[model samples]
Target: MLRVMTPTAVLLLAALPALAQPAHLQPTRDVSVTYRMNAPAAGGAPAAPQEMRMAFSVSEGKQRIDPPGNMGWMLIDRKANTAVMVMDAQRATMAMPPATVGAMTQGVPPGATFTRKGTATVAGLACTEWDVTAGQGRGTSCITEDGVLLRAVTTPPNGTPMTVMEATQVTYAPVEATRLTVPQGYSPMAMPGGAGTTPAR
Candidate 1:
């Protein structure tokens, strides 16, 4: 049987190398980035690639993420300690508490270790390279000084080909308030038990 990966699991696998962000490097401005993701086919076929655009606007401890396509968007209010997920297609919104969001983004896999390798430049930004190892799997990530991830590659323990996410574009701009607002007439729904556990996907 094929096991469906939860959002939390996906986030952990994708961001293991950058799990511990340096406090001094947190971003202070709104930014937008585009990334290309390549993943090995589950049934051993050729890899498939996808692209996504993400926007991060931080002000007064609030942040919003507008996912690729029309999938939806998410708003995180740190001061209020709440998160809301808006489903664009269905016009539905789900609410999650701070604890759930924390668990999703901050949980580190067991036996995972990270080591700073060196530095590199990506998308015209200087970044520090870090090597990560967990169990029998290995991965590497290049992160910018402001805690932005520029690239990541992971080779699973089962020996499948590596999966990668690379930033293709980066821009600093003020995020419009309208982009972060939940539209009216959207129905409210309960958050899935596992959905809010991760900020990825």
Candidate 2:
């Protein structure tokens, strides 16, 4: 899976205190959000939503991605704004360069505003784009009338416009898991220091 350094990711990396839920929201939420990501072209035909499931977490202006089937973790740090990926699968471990996530959160700060860069066509849908060029992090997202974020693009210093990420078939509800708990038989592998984070945080 490709990594995307998004503003949502940056906010997570900041690890800001969790705020109160909106007045109308349910007291307890088992929110289940689906992100169907696609690159420009990945050789094979684009896959379906039923074949994909992903989670995006933004803490203190950082981004973290947890892919399906692999016990791997991808963390994007805010201040440094670089991406660090830790891959642990099938008894083997792999790590992505540390500079990746760091670039995403380079210059963005809380309450920083972005302007709509006018409508641009990404995958053939009308988009309301925005940007913050004063710093390294660039914000670009297209949302449907139903409030579904259909497409988004983020460019850190090391990343280019070519590294676009589009998410389709998004759904957000809630989950029942109270805390981050490892399975009984699964052992925690020694991941690269760059990307691993506290399970529950």
Candidate 3:
């Protein structure tokens, strides 16, 4: 005799495909988030945790991070898979090496897998937590429905999980296009150990 499927079972079957894919790491629309960065010392030694405010914004598929202090800013283009640093004082831009691009792009490492956990509230907004496993190690990321990363944690091989960054505030608004793009007529800067300017655009 053939078995019949219940309505709930049918609905769950239809949702399986969507669940297989990981949550969106970048914001789908214009939004800004201020995060408190907690970085561990080299070699995982115990040290005072320094807190700094990083202003992040995403618009039209491009992301920008205004680092703490007057260290300038960084621009990332997901489509082009490139990250560049814009030094306003020097009026120069420097392309980030390919090795570091993965970390800069929404904290999700390349070739990583995600398993959606229960939901949580961060920065006064609802988000879904995802347990991520990658070649490097395992971690978790809480992401908003609109695709903003509210908080992220990481664990190295044979190490404990540590909070890398967590959003302290979130704002949904329109970001000016110019803020995400390189300023007009800004020259490229030569990176250390290399000669010649990297194109920024």
Per-model lDDT: 0.61, 0.38, 0.61
Best by TM-score: 3
Q: Model 3 Cα displacement at 131 (Å)? A: 1.2
Displacement of the residue 127 alpha carbon in candidate 2, Å: 8.6
Give per-candidate clash totals. Answer: 1, 38, 0
TM-score of 1: 0.72
Cα deviation at 13, candidate 1, in Å, is: 10
- Residue pairs with clashing backbones, model 1: 104-197
List TM-score per model, in order: 0.72, 0.42, 0.73
lDDT of 2 by residue, 83-190 (tens): 444443442223334443333333334555556556654434444554543344454555433333435555645565532345444444432222222223333233
| Cα lDDT tens digits for candidate 3, 20-94 | 234554566677777766656678776564333333344355667665445667776766777777778878787
Query: What is candidate 1's lDDT per residue for 20-134, written digit by digit as tens?
Result: 3433233566777777767656775666576665565667455565443445666655555556777777777776655556643444567778788888988889888777776
- lDDT accuracy of residue 183 in candidate 1: 81
Q: Residue 146, candidate 1: how far off, in angstroms?
A: 1.6
Ten residues in sequence with the least summed lDDT for candidate 1: 1-10
